[model samples]
Target: MQETNDADTTPTHVETAADLDARIDAADRLLVEFYTDGCGACAAMEPILGVVARETGVPVVTVNPRDDPALIDEYRIESVPTLLLFEDGDPVRRLADGFVGAERVIDFLA
Candidate 1:
């Protein structure tokens, strides 16, 4: 008596810089999905990112580095699909330039 694969599987939209401060400070693992407006890979990875974010109950905010030059400089992000993992506001790992999956996300932290 269980249900999985709900039809309403929209990736929760995360759109802000300040929103991250609290979560980044509290979370052991933070996945920041950095992307631009017209990135094909970024578009493709949306749902998968959402699923993982929700499953983990972590703050997965999308940072448009191009829009915010400071972010680009802050994280040194040079790719469309970059996932920056932070531990207590300190960056522990970074996965970049592609549509990496959920298992891969877990693997990065491990």
Candidate 2:
């Protein structure tokens, strides 16, 4: 995969929840964004997540809960644009307020 510092050039799309699990398990550290279609804040997080991935070298993946209804109840995702930080297949932190900037995201990863 090509790695880029610019958010516009990053490859951060995760197709399915199963793919998401494999990606997270494969990476030492990962940031997964749970989003919903037509969510303004969720849309806004795309580039920011890319920036986080580029700067921190932490692979970022995105999943729409609507794709899999079970994820909503499993993860307790009450809102759109919820961010989950994972370390070796285990979730470490969660950020689910709204549009979070790159700085806060970096700090959250730390």
Candidate 3:
């Protein structure tokens, strides 16, 4: 298995659907943002997610569902900037509103 530095606060980019599954399995609690390129709200959330990761010690990841068509269908992601909270490898919460602030993100994780 590849060694991962759990202390890293940078949001991970999930390139493929399988990689997304692997990441979720690896982390005890994970926040995944499904975003598309050229999306303003998605771009806006980048720094906010970074801060959330740093403040809460929760691993945050971003995935472009367009890169994996199956992911779009599997997650039923209808919009960019959809946030999914996964705990113990199962999805427990979803926040699909656009351009959510760091406070709301932190509260969702909490």
Candidate 1 C-alpha lDDT tens digits along 1-110 = 12323322233344455655565776665677888889999988888777765565555657677665777778888887988888778988889949878878757756
Model 2 regions lying over 4 Å from their true place: 1-11
- The stretch of ten residues in a row with the least summed lDDT in candidate 3 is 1-10
lDDT of 1: 0.69
For each candidate, what is the lDDT?
0.69, 0.82, 0.91
Model 1: colliding residue pairs: none
Model 2 TM-score (2 dp): 0.87
lDDT of 2 at 53: 80
Evaluate residue 67 in candidate 3 and report its C-alpha lDDT on the 0 to 100 scale.
96
Q: Could you tally the backbone clashes for each prediction?
A: 0, 0, 0
Model 3 TM-score relative to the real fold: 0.92
lDDT assessment of candidate 2: 0.82
Error of 2 at 63 (Å): 0.4
Report the backbone clash tally of model 1: 0
Ranking by lDDT: 3, 2, 1
Residue-wise C-alpha lDDT for candidate 2, range 1-110, written one tens digit per residue: 34544532353776567878788778787788999889999999998987778787787888887887777887789998899988989998999989989999989988
